[model samples]
Target: MPLPYFGLRARISLAVMLATLLATVSMAFAAYRLQADETRNRFELAARTSFESDLKQALYQIQYGPVTDPATALTAYMTREQGISWALLDFTSGGRPPDLWEGGYRVDAVVRRDDTPPVTLPEELVDYARRSYPEPVGKLDVDGYLVYFGAATDSLVLVEFYNMGGLNAELAKLRWSLAAIALVVSTAGVATALFAAKRIQRPVHAVATAARLLGEGELSTRVPVRGRDELADLAVSFNAMAGQVGHSISELQAKDRQQRRFIDDVAHDLRTPIAAMVAVVDSLDTADAEVRSRSARLLTAQTRRLARLVEDLLEMSRFDAGVADFRTEPVDLAALVTDALELSAPSADVELRVHGDVTLTGDPRRLHTVARNLLINAIGHGAEPITVTIDGSRPESVTLRVADSGPGIPDELLPLLFDRFVRGDRARQATEGSGLGLAIADQNARLHGAKIVAANDGGAVFTVTVPRGVTTTG
Candidate 1:
């Protein structure tokens, strides 16, 4: 199977279990080899010590007691030992074997056959013993038996053969015991690894579940933090990010609803003027001269109102799309204000005042539009005695303030003054001019890195501040 198909817990458990099993098997195998070598060395040393002791006793009996034949004494000693068999060769008597000993003794039924006599030690072993006779004791293998050789006297050598089936059986038992122990240790290790994996996987599983819920638009979903670790920190961060995303989505949805309402209002405003022009179109052709002139004038006024509304809508769209173009130049603020006032030509009772002369870098045409809109709005809603003030005393910036003598703006309307299509009151809403005048002025000021703020000290005051050495053209 692919490794990814496994869960985190299973993968971690498998990794830990494999590591434990590998270490256990390595140590077990190493211990088994060490134990086998030690067991073999111990068995060999015990056998050699027994053979040397038996030979020394036989030599003492020959020197101090009434023992005439050393070969007979060693033969009697070998027959008395149950698991040991021996052979005595007399090299002093021209290589003749001793009496009462028939060839070699067989230690097992497999080596001793009824169909034939037991096989004796070959001549190779006898010659080896004679050639290396001066050595006191040594070990060799004759047929299937393990033999230990000891030189009892100058002319006599005693060779003892031991049964190896018992040593082999003991070693086999040790191997089986070690294998069983390793199996038990490996099983216990896997269980421990699984328990550890579960502890680690709990937090991870919670995070995955929360993430899945978030993808399905459940932004409030969060994982619980239990400890001061990286996983707990991850849970905290995820919850914080989810909250931010939910708030942003809520704000965007509110803006979308406001935009839809604005589009509906634009459609309603255009319908009124177009309907009025359509109703007066045929009246101009059917009436007398005087009546026809009135009809033509009325139609011309509605047509101009519709055209202005459409132009304002188009300009708002350009500003919203960040595509409004500009041409930068130095323009005199005092001259621009005077030209706007002459163009508007308000009633004679309204007073006009020019305070200071200031020259700044900006788009002249757009700045003129700003001044004209502020003047027209003040004249329409504000009282007479309008005062226009310019202050360029600051080295880095300039300000233009237009204040009128009237009741100040409503407290609720002040906050939303620059919003598109927002009028001060119901009476002002019915006046001539689209409601986008203040909004257009606000956008134009922003394009030049400026700000327009509305407040009331004596009456309504609109202040436009433009930064020095700035251009709107990009």
Candidate 2:
């Protein structure tokens, strides 16, 4: 199964702290083991050396001196070693130790250099030593924690006991010290883990908080980037996302405002045509023939203007709703531009420049609308020299540019030139039609997998880039 889940900081702190604890404990355990073993080895070495030396001396005395002088070697040993207590067993009668210590022939008196109270060795222990005759056997006495080792020959056996309680107490202190050291180090590890986690978590927490604020309508929220790492990259990405979102929202809001203003303007424009048509209808009963004929013409003009406005409104709705479609077909680019010039601005002082046999696949009607709108905009807002260029030079795409030599588009309005109802030079846009022609043209360009870019090069320049080369079935 997967490990349990927790917060990032907690998980980080816990993992680091656990690793630290494990490493510290492993070191401490190894150190304690080595020290404890060394302490035990030191005590054991002392016992082994003293016992081997005294036993060797007693053996020498038995081999060289009179046999009755065996006690001399042991007494001399008791006088030499400070902490060692010696016991001698005589197996000449080939039996266990004597039950009595007072003048017993088989078991000699226990000899010690110190005046401490004596402990009689257990009978079972003595019997075990008798069975393990030659080899030295160690036993720990519980009362004084005396460590005993016995050695034997054919007749005489030497047993020695040394109290290890003081040494053992020192070892206990050492063990506690090690445990305390381990604990202190583990606590330090926890602190270090927390410190590290805080450094890492701070950036993440900032991003989280910023995201929350952004969601709550604080579009200006951004994260601070600190380092060239993954976390910093996340912060940078988040800040970029926030910026994009803010830009998109600002655009949406501007579009909404424009849409609202367009609606209001359309409503105001509707009354003029409708009132004129109603007046024409009201004058039908008048008998003056010239007045009736002029009223009839007024009615017809108002009716046509209203119909055109309604059609423009419907087209705008289609574009906004994303239902306007572009059906691709083989199109003659230069011929379409020439037709648009004649239909939209035939009488204007405009030049039509067709470059090569410009044939491409595109939506003819939409492409024509793009040309028609650019021509209309130029004639309405531009001056003497109007030029439309149909450039099919690039193998991958068809380019159309409609430029006019007039007082150029205002710098403030250039960015939003194609936004619906965004009319600059109020006198120029005072036509009786819906102000959605340029916006529709822009949308149609995008629908055809292209874009309309507007700039001011001496005057207003509108360039329509229609992507081609990639063949389409329909």
Cα RMSDs, all models: 6.7, 5.5
TM-score of 2: 0.77
lDDT (10s digit) by residue, model 2, range 75-130? 55556666666666655564454454433223336776543344455555555665
Candidate-wise lDDT, in order: 0.76, 0.77
TM-scores of the models, in the given order? 0.67, 0.77
Query: Candidate 1, which segments miss by more than 4 Å at Cα?
Result: 1-9, 19-93, 96-205, 215-217, 226-228, 326-366, 427-430, 469-474
The per-candidate count of clashes, in order, stands at 0, 0
lDDT of 2: 0.77
Model 2, residue 240: distance off in Å is 3.4
Judge candidate 1 against the unseen true structure and give its global Cα lDDT, from 0 to 1.
0.76
**Clashes by residue pair, model 2:** none
Model 2 ranges with Cα > 4 A deviation: 1-26, 68-82, 94-109, 113-146, 179-218, 227-238, 285-292, 341-351, 382-387, 403-413, 424-430, 453-461, 470-474
Candidate with top lDDT is 2
